[model samples]
Target: MLHKLNLEHILFLDIETVPEYKDFDSLSDELKYLWADKTKYQRKEDFTPEEFYERAGIWAEFGKIVCISVGFFSFKGEERSFRTKSFFGEEKEVLIEFKNLIESHFNTPYHLLCAHNGKEFDFPYIARRMIIHGISLPQKLNLFGKKPWEIPHLDTLDLWKFGDYKHFTSLKLLTHILGIPSPKDDIDGSQVREVYYEEQDIDRIIIYCEKDTVAVAQILLRLRQEELLSDDEVISV
Candidate 1:
């Protein structure tokens, strides 16, 4: 049963990352290369890592938190509704808003914060930004030097340990395997910042956030048990 995991107050979340500088001449070659790798994230273009980072700023700036999309969902009875909020723009303002939001409801009866690649990305990203904002992180989230498996983290990406460490697993692939229809709307994560910058449309970003959140939930469901989905679901983001 899903309850076996014993996640009481679960906040499923995903984040959008961006670097502080478009290209930081200050960082050394190693660090620059490291950052360049993340810039290639979810990109379909034939871009070398350097080109990816040079063309687009992502994962630079050490601890710049861009968009924090938190999806709060309770799994118990059949009645279900998820409260999701997204905070983006300027790291300081975003972190302040995110901290306020998290602090406001975190004391409520809840269990854990769940994410797909959160251990590697989302959780630390949020925690570091909170620290930058002089806001303490929620107790359960301050893993601080603990092994991921030893912590209260339920990273769905790591859960898919089908013995292929090198396998490139994605939220979309998980959706396909679990038969959950994805509502991506043909938008790619690479274009997220551009959409935010060019169109200045929060709605598109929110839709993207919803697509990823739903993917996170489905990934969690797959981890706890099997992927369950009814008809009328579409896949493509």
Candidate 2:
């Protein structure tokens, strides 16, 4: 088990998904077919089967990724700098860029990927879409057989759980719990499509994702500090 991780050796990533095609009346039957079991949290009201069948067409055509923001903090002795790279545009092109970045410098032997709920959402979605684009996943993404928890993935949601699964914890809630000030997330996820279409603005989504990356980094810092302090106290005692 990898403990006391070097943040510099970890890749913190987040991805946003859109339908495979867009500007259509109804989602393609094929895209709808791909929508099988992507949901991770419980909604207060159960969606009807027809309602649930929604977004399939959206995912099939454009099936493009709207954004992939990556952030990592590295230390020069004691000073650590947080650096990030965000890709937003055509799914194929954006995915190509994402693949190249992962393949380029992160080509180290192994690096733990830190994400906010990536086990359920981001990781597999990125993998499937990368295959869709005919892009081969990097060698480090070879953590195939391991269960979600078994991998070196650090999910802020799971850590927020504190072992209790009572309520669904959104990233905003997790940030609030950690006393970390989250960005102005007044806009909800449902609004992204409209904002992207009618407003013709992709900046909003990029900004939203950027804030999420910072939140992920902050959560990592908090966890690392707590764990390090705990270890140090044990040593002192």
Candidate lDDT values, in order = 0.64, 0.64
Give the alpha carbon lDDT tens digit for every residue of 107-141 in model 1.
45345677877767777777776776777776656
Relative to the unseen true structure, what is the C-alpha lDDT of residue 70 in candidate 2, on a scale of 0 to 100? 84
Q: Give the Cα-based TM-score of candidate 1 against the true structure.
A: 0.71
Score residue 150 of candidate 1 by CA lDDT: 55
The TM-score of predicted model 2 comes to: 0.75
Candidate 2 runs further than 4 Å off:
1-3, 23-63, 146-152, 162-167, 184-186, 226-237
Candidate 1 regions exceeding 4 Å error are 6-8, 21-50, 54-57, 60-63, 75-78, 107-110, 145-150, 162-164, 225-237
Strongest candidate by TM-score: 2
Q: What lDDT tens digits, residue by residue, belong to model 2 across residues 119-221? A: 6677767777788878787655556786655565667776666788674677777778777667446564566666666776888877777667777877777
Error of 2 at 116 (Å): 0.7
Question: What C-alpha lDDT, on a 0 to 100 scale, does residue 100 get in candidate 1?
Answer: 71
- Clash pairs for candidate 1: 9-110, 9-111, 182-234, 184-237, 187-237
